[model samples]
Target: MRRWPRIAAWCVAALVLAGAALGSATVYFGWYDVSATGPHTVPVYALLDVASTRSVKLRSADIDVPDLDSPDRIRRGDALYRAQCAQCHGGPGQAPEPYALGLNPAPPPLVTSARERPAAEVFWIIRHGIKMTGMPAWQYRMTDEQIWDVVGYMRVLPTLSPQQYRDGAPSGGPASSLASASTSPSSSATATPPGDMRVGDMRVGDAKAGRAALQQYLCVTCHAIPGVPGARHYVGPSLDGMADRSRIAGVVPNSPDYMQRWLMDPQGIKPGTAMPALGLREQDARDIAAFLQTLSNFE
Candidate 1:
């Protein structure tokens, strides 16, 4: 019996040594293929896929997802996805760009896969992006709401056809199409023209420039603004109907000067608020104020 115990220990030590030798040899001889052309071995692929999925699930468990079914939210998400994601993930009707095919671990079609994921997981992946995959951390470029918007559209993407994608996709990047449309004379939804819409005693800044400044300040990440295409945020209050509101933060009067000051330094205006001071230049503040003033007729 004592001999048997010794023998078993030797067997375990031998197996460990053998594994170490094989691993070292593989690394030393460069036995693993790094080429993208060939698919991974079945075991390797299964391990990687499982690991990736589990990682996302574990990490995204705490994310609080919002209502992702709103038509307006989906539209905003569609524009953003077309501009930033279509090349890699493809749309309902759009094919993945040729460059995406060359990726070693091919990007899965989100139409089917995104449906399989929870919106919170999708939001986490979009916000933090996966490492070693070409996916980027859009936290720097896109806002929380914008990320959620993409998730929203992705949830419904499996149902869309190519023709539907073509018909419904917004014409350009959010920064361009929405800005131009908001300023176009015929783009107003209400009976009165947006150019003629007025806020009492408040000077409207240049609408076009205000739109540009909005992008520059990265306001789209937190506030969903009407006429701003993919500006689907939920972090802060929606600025869509700000023009008609009697108060700015529901505490102060909604006047041009108050808005400009608020824009210049939000924390100063409302202490302990979640809004950040984007450090808008005086003119930038004016331009944003002017653009926001037009929201009354935006619909």
Candidate 2:
């Protein structure tokens, strides 16, 4: 045992020395490429990505998310994103400006990637900012509500075309212009009453499709949804009695409209939640809602 301990200590010491020597040599010789034009090797980029995601997840896990999806909130977020984020991250219509393109490890396009992350993690990254990267801490510069508003807008960013995005902006022309553009099912079809068999207000969509939607969107990775076999993960709260619950995410009332909104942008319903916006279509959210409602009496 004594010899084993000594051997382990020597091995650890050797590893530390080797790491130190390698780091010093890299610094002294400038062997690692620091140029923006020269991308990090695939393995290096993967490692950094994993580290950043893990760190964000661990640090932001405790933040209490509030509702992030509302008409006003999304509008506000859209304005802010256009004004500030579009310069670097770009959007549907806007390409990243030259300044952003020159940045080392260039900022990823938010419209494509933001929905995949938890709202809390995105909030933390926005508020605290990442070191070494160009992202600055916004907590000092912007209010919590504003950061959340930006997050809310990001939820819908993937869905918006450049024209829709520009129109939604206060300076981008009249909001009425959107009427000509919106081809969504809810907007295109004749308005149906609350309990219509095709698309009810409270109980809409096919349950079987909802289950499939849950699986397709990887909801089981976090929630232990009833009826979905093998959906027992504990990252978020269980969905066993989601239908009976009066409130969704402790805020929005449990109704089909609210649930659809929740599914579209959970952070908008409750900011800083582990639930990321999955960017599902209106009909898809309705399908998921129908399935979730059936879980009220689940065993």
Candidate 3:
């Protein structure tokens, strides 16, 4: 009987070693397909989704988003959108690039996406970015002001009316579009950016109204603050005090219009950017900017 116990332990150990060898073979032999095109098996996908969500939450705990929206902020945001984001994500009433229409999660329109997540989550996704899924991180290429402008614009994109897409005026991409849009030779605290509607080069509407509309859109997902609840992993940035940031997405001016442009289609500004275009309408974008402008880091 005593000998039987020792024999059983050896048998179990042998089985475990065999299983390890099998698992290794599966990987080394390319038996498991890693292609995104290959839909995940139900169990595998479920497990991965759970793991992804958990990992994002754990990894993004330390990120921060500056006060993002303001009269100046939203305008710049609007410009950023026009110059960099408009094509892929579109604004107010337009649609995203044909690709956005077909993407897996079907890029939620920011107008509504903000409501779905917190501001910090939005910001983290914009800054640190995502892996695989074509969502590139912007921490390297962009400036802080640029990122925040996008954040502020996202807050109010859900309320815009619509913009008519023009041919060949401007496009997204850091080098080409940003160099032209980054600095506005003429702008004031309340004045808007020119030519680009999303950039807020021109005034959109009431600031207080914009702020209210932004909160209604739910711009407080992933952002951290002195008091907002929940962890910062819902997929966007928080907006407790977004108006004070000097930059957006680490680039661009922090104006309402600019916020509009960046929020409408951030992928254009930073190619492969994970920040999904919320398909914001023009009026919605403006409102979001207005709302963001109200947030300030008053000491």
Q: Could you tell me every candidate's TM-score relative to the true structure?
A: 0.56, 0.53, 0.44
Which rank order by lDDT, best down to worst?
A: 2, 1, 3
For model 2, residues 1-299, the per-residue Cα lDDT tens digits are 68999999999999999999999999899998777545455567557767888899999999998898789998898778877787776555344554564565556667645667888988999999987768899999889999999998888887876555555666443223223323344422223424444533334578788876665454654566654532112435788888899999889799977888888666456644445444465677889888888887745
* True lDDT of residue 20, candidate 3: 99
Alpha-carbon lDDT of model 1: 0.67
What tens-digit string does per-residue lDDT give for candidate 1 at 1-299? 79999999999999999999999998899997766544455567557767878999999998877888899999899888888987766554243554664565556557655656788888888888887767889999999999889888888877775445555755674323323433454422212322442445445478788876665454553566665532221335678778888998866899887898887655456644444444355666888888888888556
Q: List where candidate 1 sits over 4 angstroms from the true fold.
A: 171-299
Per-residue error for 13 in candidate 3, Å, reads 5.7
Candidate 1: deviation at residue 36, Å? 1.5
Per-residue CA lDDT of candidate 3, range 60-115, in tens?
Answer: 67767677758788767767766556554455434355454334322334545556
